[model samples]
Target chain A: MHPRLTLALTLIEAVAILAYAISGFIEARKRRLDAVGTFLVGFATAFGGGTVRDVLLEHRPFYWVEHQTYVIVLFVASLFAPFVLRTLSRLFSERALLVADAIGLGLFSISGTSIALEAGMPAFTATLMGVATGVFGGLIRDVLCNVVPLILRDSRPYATCAFAGCWLYLLLDHFDVDSVYSLIIATAFILIARLVTFKLNVRLPH
Target chain B: MHPRLTLALTLIEAVAILAYAISGFIEARKRRLDAVGTFLVGFATAFGGGTVRDVLLEHRPFYWVEHQTYVIVLFVASLFAPFVLRTLSRLFSERALLVADAIGLGLFSISGTSIALEAGMPAFTATLMGVATGVFGGLIRDVLCNVVPLILRDSRPYATCAFAGCWLYLLLDHFDVDSVYSLIIATAFILIARLVTFKLNVRLPH
Candidate 1:
């Protein structure tokens, strides 16, 4: 909770939100949704997971509500969704977007798990909370887009990676490791594992 | 609230939950999901709307969490889903199900609007909250079933009915009417309107 670490986490969260929003924008456009629908889908993709986590933990003043700046940014971005989408695609490859999303998944999962544990949830429940935080945004986006959630259908081990990462964070915390290092290590573990699995086409067995 | 009125509202809510859960059961069975998946979907349908309302209003210990019996009932129902489905179909026609669902929509919408108003939200936001609570359970069900939400795709006057009903309740409350009477009037208005519109094939023009 040092000032520098807190600042770093906030920056990473912003990036993650942006990454998730881009996917929402793409899907909304594909569905030919209007500006309002586009903005809503984008907002949900960016904030849905955290919102769900806060709700389950009975936390108040939702992350988006507290960080009104994020809502404003998304609103403005949504106004010129086409232009924003073009600019992002031009600046970053699909691979880069995937990497950013993976980092976001890692950070969100660990944070959610940590918060649940602090709320006195058992380890199993906390780990599930972490996974929910990591994946619920995309799940909601797909629902809005009228498709099966990719996480539910895809065999790329997305939630599994989050599950592992959450357990790692919990273990480190249990051993009284410095939280800053534990957070970074667990996040990196998820990020690397996600990318590696996606590349190798590793899948969960049906 | 009078004890009798409180009991009436609770009973209405239970019926609403059961109706919503039935829809989930049908969808999950159609998808051929396992017992666990069926239970999860049923639980979501039964509670998704109220849960979303609670989250938005920052209400704690979610309705389902507070009413553990609901969870137990849904779990047991899920275990005998096939049998329940058969029994239900035999006992009630499709039209009967629609009637029950419409009544549920009315009750949930009015209650949600009333709750939001109690929490100090503006009229417009409270109305939206009501519509959300009325329709979200089915929305989640359709999403989990990998289809566009019926509310989004159907031209039927589903959410519109909820919207108008919420306004009616709000107006009555603003006029200082007794809540018990207002609740009954608004819920009946929605129920009758929904059934009539469905019968007449009312469609919102795109």
Candidate 2:
């Protein structure tokens, strides 16, 4: 991978992690959890999906374990979550959260799919892994919060977008598209699809 | 390391897995899940703790993956869960379920702690890992059932027994006790502690 692409991916991942952590902080606040509980929930939300993916793939040195900085950042942020999130919520509207979360869903899904494929998983299983990577953090968050997972209950096309994007990534890679371009395109595809579906209130049939 | 001890451990593990799967089957039935959902829940309940332990310890070829027979058995049992569990429930009293679950908690916690120690984890982390391994399957089951995990909400001594038992195992190992004896002693400690606590209606202070 080119240094430029690696750098870009890292930045995007940081954004995604931040988005996830904020959601966890918000939920923890809603539950009136203590600072420690807030931190644990925030950490789980930020790292849970990647951790689950790495575990399933039998990969070592979990992403959070590898990136101590992310853990430290989340820890510090969680300490002041109640105050920090209040200001953040005032600055960033719900639309901003939606955009950030959509981007996270896309990038995490494609990256997870790519890693699974590289690990020689079957394509179908790889796609499922992608969806898992994209959604499992929130799933864990909801579980910790004692609520039904949004992906399972919400009719919206969250994991569906990731699923379609993963297949698109696989298709592009199969057709010999440039790796960097394939990633960017598939991620963008998911992001746009997610936003469009949310805007249209598109839902799966009951 | 003796074959006899290995066989004994394996037998205990099978019993534990059956207990966990039965709990999951019961929960899924209560939730009125379809056959597929029931199977997934059963599989998770049976394997979730060990899988989480393996993932945390960076162990490969998950327990269920290595023991394909277990997966097949659970799969087959899940297919007939509604009828099978009904009959099993009639034959086994609630006391039976409690006994099996306690045995599972003991075995899984000690094994998890032993594995973590072998993996060179610090003692505190290993003890937590043991508690996680003992409680996580039921935690996952509750999550899938969209309920707060029993470990988190219940003021029972479930995870407490695992935690204390793990420390006992660590102490025994530190004293150079025979490995088989250490395992058996620690497991028995947890099993008896759990059963006694339950019978006495022990509750953590609110």
Candidate 3:
């Protein structure tokens, strides 16, 4: 991979991790889970998808396991989540959740696709894995909360954006595009598509 | 992996997979899911735990993927599930569910531990993975059905049985017991314990 693309992915990963952890924290609080449950849910939300992808691709020691600092960061963040949530509740709104989810989806989807491609998966499987990596964390969290998975039931174009973005990335890569450009363009497309879907109330038939 | 032990595991695995799939089919029908959803949930319940285990241990070409017959069997069974379920509604009762669940828990718990040991995991991690493999299929199914996991909140000796059984297997192995005997004793213990717990109305205080 290009050095610049690696750097870009690293940066996107950081943001995605934080966004997903916060999303988990919020869901944990809503479910009235204790601190331990909060941390477990937050940790799962941050790392579950990539872990599954890595496992599927026969990548050992998982991404988080390889990056100890990520685990520590999530642990410390989870320790402070309840206090931080209390302070943010007055200012936080659904918009924050929406934005965070969109950004995380885009970044994780691109990263997941890149990993699958590197692992020599076919385009369809790679794209499917990308969408799965973007969505399964929330699926796990909702399962923990005993709710029908939002991606499965909701009409919104959640996994669809990830799927489309992955195809764009695959298409660009097929045409000899630079890795860095492909990553950026695909991520941006997913982000914009997600937000646009929300703005336009775009939905699949339920 | 002795030949006898391998044969035992293969037979046990077949039973566990079938039992878990049936459990999933019942849950999907109860929820009124369509055929696709029924198959998805059934597949997940049958394979989800072992998939997670193999991925964690860096085992490539998952068991079901390696043995395509299992997938075919699950697919065919799923196609017939709604019909079979309606006909068996009178024949299938809670007792069958409990018995199937107990047998699955016992067999999967031992198999998971064996795999983890073969993968060179520490005893504690191996034991934990064993219990996880035993219970996670049910966890996935319940999550899909929008219910709190039985292991997490039912106050029953669900995961407790698996955990205890894994430890027994670990201890027997530690004592240099024959592999076949250790597997048999441990699995029997879990099955009996689970059934006894239900029969006696034994539950942990919530």
Candidate 4:
């Protein structure tokens, strides 16, 4: 495994934990769910993607076991988000969700690709797994929140961004690029692709 | 597999397909989803567990490939379900869901355990895989639907039923019991145990 890539994945994991935790809290408020319900939704959203990947790979002890702090962080963030994010959303002209979601897509895609490479899967499968890992958490979050999946719908470029970014990462690595350079380049592709798609209202029909 | 056990498992699979398909379709309607959405949800509910099991085991072609009828049946059923199941649910109650889920659990647990044993996995690991095959589908579906997962929630016999039934099936098979007898016995154990838990509102706390 590439050490720099591992560090990058950890950073992305932290970002995702924070973003999903906030989103979960916001959705819970929209549904008028109780505190327990809010925390549970947040918790699922935070862990859903990585958990699925770990299970698929037969990775023992699971990633969450080694990093229990992420859970504790999400718990605290969710508790505070309702007070901060909800109020800010009412006042800000910009949409916080779109940016946060884009960042999350980038982070998750990068993390997923790295993990797949670590497991020694081929590039094609690694790209698919990466995109799946990035988007699956949100897929699950939407389902539990009683909404349609963002990925299956022609709603936006959510998964496409992940796919594109992962491929770019893999392509660069094939050329034996520097790890940090590849990480930045790949993550930028995801972030930019997602943001551009969202801004232009792009959607995939199939 | 015992010839007789195979037959019993077939019956259980059919019943499970119908039950989960109905539940999936019902959830789709509640969300006002399109026909595609309805069908996808139904398919996931019916075959998601087995698919996950096959993927984990690196089994080629997957279960649905051999049993293409299962997918077709769910597809056809989804179109008519919104109308048919409402009337049916009124009479049968959610008990149908429980019974069907239990049947699937029993069959899947047996298949998973037997496969793992064949592969020479340790008994503990084999048992875990068996439980996963039986229960992981619902967990995946719940995540997709964005609802608190039934398995992880502190309020259900859920995975416990699968876990218990897998061991029972293993013990019976170890004794070279008649395949048909083991199938029937294991299925009954899961179904009765599951139904009783539901009627009594049994659940484990986190």
Residue pairs with colliding backbones in model 1 are none
Candidate 4 structure quality by residue, lDDT tens digits, B107-169: 777677777777777888888888887777667666556677667874778678878887898
At residue A40, give the lDDT of candidate 3. 87
Ranking by lDDT: 1, 2, 3, 4
What lDDT tens digits, residue by residue, belong to model 1 across residues A130-199? 8788888988998888876676546568888998999999999999999888989999999999999999
lDDT of 1 at B168: 95
- Give candidate 4 misplaced runs (Cα > 4 Å): A1-16, A60-69, A90-93, B1-47, B51-113, B116-206
CAPRI band of model 4? incorrect
Per-residue lDDT over A111-133 for candidate 2, one digit per residue giving the tens place of the 0 to 100 score: 99999999999999999999999
**True lDDT of residue B166, candidate 1:** 94
Q: Rank the candidate models, highest TM-score first.
A: 2, 1, 3, 4
Clashing pairs in 2: none
The predicted structure with the larger TM-score, 2 or 3, is 2
Residue-pair clashes per prediction, in order, are 0, 0, 0, 8
DockQ of the candidate models in sequence: 0.14, 0.14, 0.16, 0.13
C-alpha displacement of B165 in model 1, angstroms?
1.4
Question: Candidate 3: global Cα-lDDT?
Answer: 0.82
